[model samples]
Target: MTALAALVDFWDEEIDRWVSGHAGVSDRLQPWFESYRGRGHGEVRLDAFPEPYTGRLIGNSTPVVMLGLNPGAAVPRFQAPGGVFFEQLKTLRYSEWAATVPYASKEWESIAGPNRFYQNRFAFARRLLGEPNWSIANGVYFELYPYHSSGVNASMEPPGDVIREFVLDPIGDLDTQHVFAFGKPWFSVPARIGLPPGRVLSAKWEIPSREARIYSLPSGQDLIVMAQNGYAGPPGAGDTEALARAIGLR
Candidate 1:
C-alpha cells in the first residue's frame, strides 16, 4: 500500500479502537469523553460521531495544508458510522467532503446551514490556489487532535508518539510549500516539535486586530499560524486575502 493509504489505515484502526472501547484508547481520550458524558441525556454516543480524516494526497504529497485544533461537535445522525457520510471518510473520497460546500448534500445543508465556517476559513486558500484548485484533493486539513469536541478541552493532550508518527512524519514527506494553521493553540505545536520560533506579523486591519505568525520549516516551507477570538468569528474573505498577500502567496 502507498504511504497515504497506510496513514488512512492507521486512522481507521485508531478510530475503531476508540469506538470499541479497547484498553489504552481511553487514556488518551478520557478527559474529553468524561466531559461529554457529564452533559447527560440527548448527547450523541461518542462512537457514533465521525472521526476527523479529511484531505487527499497527490501521489503521497500535498502542496498546501490547513490545520485546526479538533473537529467541532455535531449531531450523530449526520455522521453515523455506517452512514454514507462516514463511508466517504472510510474510503478517503474527500473531494466533496472537504470542499467549501462540505458533503454537498441537501440534508447536511438543512442541518448545518451554508457552512460559512469553511467558506470563511478557506478564503485564503481560494485566493492562493484559485477556487477550483483550493480543495483537500489538492492539499489537506489535519487536526492536531482528531476527535470531536464541543469546546476546547484544555486538559486534553495528544500522545507524543501519535504526533511524531501520524503527524510530523507524514508532513515531512509532503514537500508542502505552505501550511495555514487556525487558532492560537496551534502556536505551541511548532515549538514542541523543535521547529524554530515563528515570526509574528502585524495585521492591524483585521477585525479585532489579530496577529499572524510565520514559521520557516527546515524543509524550506512556510507555516503561517493565526489566532482569533471566538467572538470575532472565522476569518472573512478580506481577512484571508489580505493575509495571503501579506505572506506573498500571490
Candidate 2:
C-alpha cells in the first residue's frame, strides 16, 4: 500500500480504539487533525494527542519500527509548528519531517531530522551496524502512547491495550524485520479492570540468561524492548552493540 494509505489505515484503526468516547475525530477537528496544511514557523512542537509515526519508509517499506512511550514536548526543527489543533495534534509523516532536520536527514532522506532521548539509541545502534545497515532511512520511529507525554508517568493506562492492539498489529502486518520497543509497560497484567494492560516487555525479562534486552513477540517478529527508559550499558537494560550482533534477522 502507499505510505499515505498505510498512514490513514493506521490512524483509522488506532483513533477509533483510543478515542472511545467519540465515533472518530471530532467534526470540528477533521481538517486540522487529519493533516497539517504546510510547514509552520518556529520549531515544531510534536507534543499533541495522537501523534503520527515519524520517518520515511524507503520505497514504502520500513524494515524497522522504533517504538517508544510517547512524543515528548519539544521545539525541534524536525516537526512543523502546525502540529497542534484545539489540544489535538497531527504530525507530518516522518519521512517528510526528517528531511528538514540537519543530521537526522543526514544519510536518511527525510523532510528533516532530530532527537536525543531517542537519538542515543540510534547512535548506539550505528556504533554496531554502521551506515545504512541500520539507519533512519531504513527505519521508522513511533511511541506506544497514542497521545503526547512529557514524562512517562503522565499518561493513563486504560487506553494502552487498545493502543497496543491497533499500533503493534499494524507493524506486524508490515514486512518489518525488527521493532525496537523502548521503555517498559506502565500497567501490570490483568489490571484492575481485569484486562491485560498494554506493555512492551524488556528483553532481559524474557530470558534470564541473555545479557541483552531484545525479544520476539508472538508474531515471530523480532521486537527489541528497552527499560521504561531507553538506555544502554550500566543502569540501562542491554547494550545496543550486543543487540546489533544478536539481531540475526537483520
Overall lDDT per candidate, in order of appearance: 0.58, 0.44
Q: For model 1, state the Cα shift of residue 182 in Å.
A: 0.5
**Considering only N, C-alpha and C atoms within 3 Å, which residue pairs clash in candidate 1?**
none
What is the per-residue lDDT of model 1 for residues 1-250, given as tens digits with 9 covering 90 to 100?
6444566665556655533444133564444344322132323245554444455544534456777766666556655556545555555434334432343357667776666555555555666654755553454667766655566635334544555555555665576777777787667667766778878765544577575788886657787777777622336666766776677664
Cα lDDT of candidate 2 equals: 0.44
Query: In candidate 2, what are the lDDT values of residues 162-211, reduced to their tens digit?
Result: 54454555566667667665554522212422432334333333334333
Candidate 1 clashes: the total is 0
Candidate 2, position 119, lDDT:
60
Worst 10 residues of 1 by lDDT: 35-44
Candidate with top TM-score is 1
Worst 10 residues of 2 by lDDT: 35-44
Off by over 4 Å in 2: 1-7, 10-49, 74-114, 128-134, 155-161, 186-215, 228-238, 246-250
Clashes of each: 0, 16
